[model samples]
Target: MSLSPSTLSPPPLSLYVHIPWCVRKCPYCDFNSHQGRGELPFAAYVDALLADLDLDLPLVWGRTVQTVFFGGGTPSLMPGELIDRFLQGASSRLRFAPGCEITLETNPGTVEHGSFKAYCDAGINRLSFGVQSFDDGCLQRLGRIHDSSEATAAIKLAQDAGFDNINLDLMYALPGQNLAMAESDLEQAFALQPTHMSHYQLTLEPNTVFAARPPSGLPDEDGSWDIQEHCQAMLADAGYRQYEVSAYARPGRECVHNLNYWKYGDYLGIGAGAHGKITSGHDQSILRRWKLKHPAAYLEAADSERGIGGDELIATERRPFEFMLNALRLVDGFSLTGFEASTGVPRSAIQAQLQEAVQKQWLLVDGDAVRPTALGRRFTNDVVELFLTG
Candidate 1:
């Protein structure tokens, strides 16, 4: 017998493997990554990750994996043999759909060209390098371990390793940044010729070093806005498509793993501090799970039946907000049908507020989708607030 609509499961899945250690944490970084010393237990970590995936297997049955992303403090730091072992172990649990996108995130200072090439041979088809800036002073201010020259070399090395699908991560609105300086940073990134670029504006998030002791280099509001606008234009002129607020790509080089997140696709996150949202309908219910943070704690608890710290089942009311928060980040918002398909809710649920937003000129109303107007994107907090009636 065919499953009921409520019993229908999410489509082909994705996996996110988190590596929690970095050589040193940047002052502006607020991710769950941590700084460490001494030698790493690569073999042990790989075993733990596979064990974690084994616990998640029931949710992955019959679903082919379309993508795998190795993200973290610095995935490139893990020896190539460990990456291969991890992939081999994952394959035994779930089958990969043909031509799946496999990605590894690297920092310019960590791995050399030989190691990058080894990663490619180990089944990493894409490389995303953290090359925040090409300005020496900006690099130093950001506490990046790599210099401007090293950043350039890293990109060339990836290319030499036959990684045509590569991405560079850059940050603008940094401390002591001016419009001219930001432009120069973009210019250097363009010269690298990576298939994709993610240019994020630096924000002083709470609990970060910048928040505790305000830095001297951050721009004023007006200055920050100016820098963002000009940089967007620069990227556009350089043949990059601004697909999302912070992501740009050449033709078809957009990161599939990221697109999955934006479209509300299901993912399994493994490793310390990693959070996952899974939409499974096995028993007519959807569930989400999140693992604990702190590597030491996770490692200590890996043998248990449930190493995760928390799990939440999303309800009808909360799902729309979660869906829109991600979809709207795209320059062109998702289709109305996409909303229904992804959220399992009808368009009528949010139509009234959507109409009101259009009337106020806060959103652009296309027939099946809605997008923020320039003004709306500028005041995104207000736009999102209009949807909060609960």
Candidate 2:
């Protein structure tokens, strides 16, 4: 059942658990998040999450989970006890690597009454807070529930609770946000001294409220680039290195779970709207599976085959584009040998595309290592499109 001639080896495995409920959905968010009406079904959702994982367990039978991330809607909303219960069940079914980086994405608004210590005790070593901006007006414009002070207090609370490996999520080029306001946000984040930071420009995603009705006073392309350039310089001066396009980290603090993803590793994604990518050595093939998106429907179908929303097998021709989509995002880029191992396709398949990119000064192929040039990184889409159409 192999699709390509290149030998394939499974990479590090991670687990992604998606929580679909949020107190209030942000207008700019395009993720599969829904606003919670009343009390959320925490207990029932935990049960369903475990059930979903059970169904997907066979895909990685003997594999050890190298990392675990509880991504959200607002994972901070789920109480600690239930998270502990889910971890217990999962560890029993599959092996977890020692000192695995288990992260929970926290909404600053939701963490106001939450217990960070309880989460720490539940084996969550890392916390990523959604603190989009330090400007209250910008926060309001983005429909974020947490104001500037709340975001600061939330990080302090996590810090006091002994969370050293914290990540602050920030966005720039918001409505009514100027270069100075964006600098202020970075300054505030630097004071927190988080292990990592995810900084990116805010764009209107389709189907979202912002996209349907665009926000007023949004920064133009040049303005956004100015903000990005200044903030990146500030981050570097503050000891945060730009590892990926949007991700920055202190030395040795890069997110392991996300690194696995960037390296085209294996992962089991369970919970509503969660997507999983697995590489099977038995068949030398790759499988991508996703669960039902709606919480209610996913809850009802969790323990059954009906929970699966869709599955896609990677065709031999599509491997290069798929591999480049993740691999090319890295600053250091990937090695030729690593590419073949991950994609199960020979390097010769992409030689023409590689040569073209090199000739155009878009990529630098130094021996076995291939990395994007500054010009290419700026036009990453165009560089990736070469492989897409190859």
Candidate 3:
């Protein structure tokens, strides 16, 4: 049965630009990132990104962008001039919120001392560093190009350059990582004073080198659980509260772009291998579109339809599961009124699943707001699966 789309008031919109080149691809990474061969075509890529944005403008015409994220192999690899040009071009075409939270993902080894100021001048107000681990041995085992010391230095440089809102991405449960080592990594990260921290486990994704040859001494299920619980306590005690499973942040410093995503809001994805979800109130339909995965292919087709990888209209039946996949990740859970407006489906549609979850101690339904219980948060996969249509 093909499901039709429904809608109430449209959700807030955001922009995501993908930069697909990296100095090197980490073994555990499964993102669409290619190793740079020589001087990357930064200028040309920026032009292509603008043209791609021009193509997508009609989809979100007149909408104000609430947040913008530059994600990729390493967005910091792009020179400041190109980033400024891209943002200038984008703003000229679409209205950007006056105080839009703009973020750039940086790899410690790839960025220099003066680049942070340039990024700031280009309108990037926030930074997220890929500081996977502070343990040098763990860094080597993870095949990270940046050492723990370099990560520390790079963060301090950004701090000096006037960026106080920063996030450090750390991975726990690594191949030779113990509880003590994980604690030490967090301690060092605390010293850096990043506004936000994203702590997740090191899962070996398919098609990656790590999955092909799994690392030895990897933590067992019980060991991984121990590490996560300990890290949670450490983060909370340090004044960074866990707002999501892997995300911890001070009050009001939570990542706006990621919040939009987890709340199932709309966003435009520009550049190679970028995927976007947009809800069109005009047609009462939701659209999922993506650009070509290969940078070369995306560039060649930049200003035309050929640049588009594919567009999928989100069917009505799947909206519940789709919404839950993102919405349930939040600690406060989702609101019924907001859910109805975003999904265009009535709360009654998922009432059975909601009751089942509540009965299983996986969810707590208090009037209009629905939040996951601690048990539900731990078994998120199972909780989300209850909404699937069979």
User: Model-by-model lDDT, in order?
Assistant: 0.84, 0.91, 0.93
Flag the better candidate by lDDT, 1 or 3: 3
Give the root-mean-square deviation of each candidate in angstroms.
Answer: 2.6, 1.4, 1.3
How high a TM-score does candidate 3 get?
0.98
The reply for model 1, stretches above 4 Å from the true place, is 1-12
All candidates' TM-scores? Answer: 0.95, 0.98, 0.98
Instruction: Point to the candidate with the largest lDDT.
Output: 3
Model 1: worst 10 consecutive residues (lDDT sum): 1-10
Residue pairs with backbone overlap in model 1:
175-217, 176-217
Give the candidate order by descending lDDT: 3, 2, 1
Tens-digit lDDT string for candidate 3 (1-390): 333244455799999999999998999999999999988999989989999998898899778999999999889999998899999999999999999999999999999877998999999999999999999899999888999889999999999999999999999999899999999999999998899999999998999999999999999999999999999999999999888879999989999899999999999999999999998888888899999999999988988989999999988888888999999999999999888888888888888999999999999999999999999999999999998896
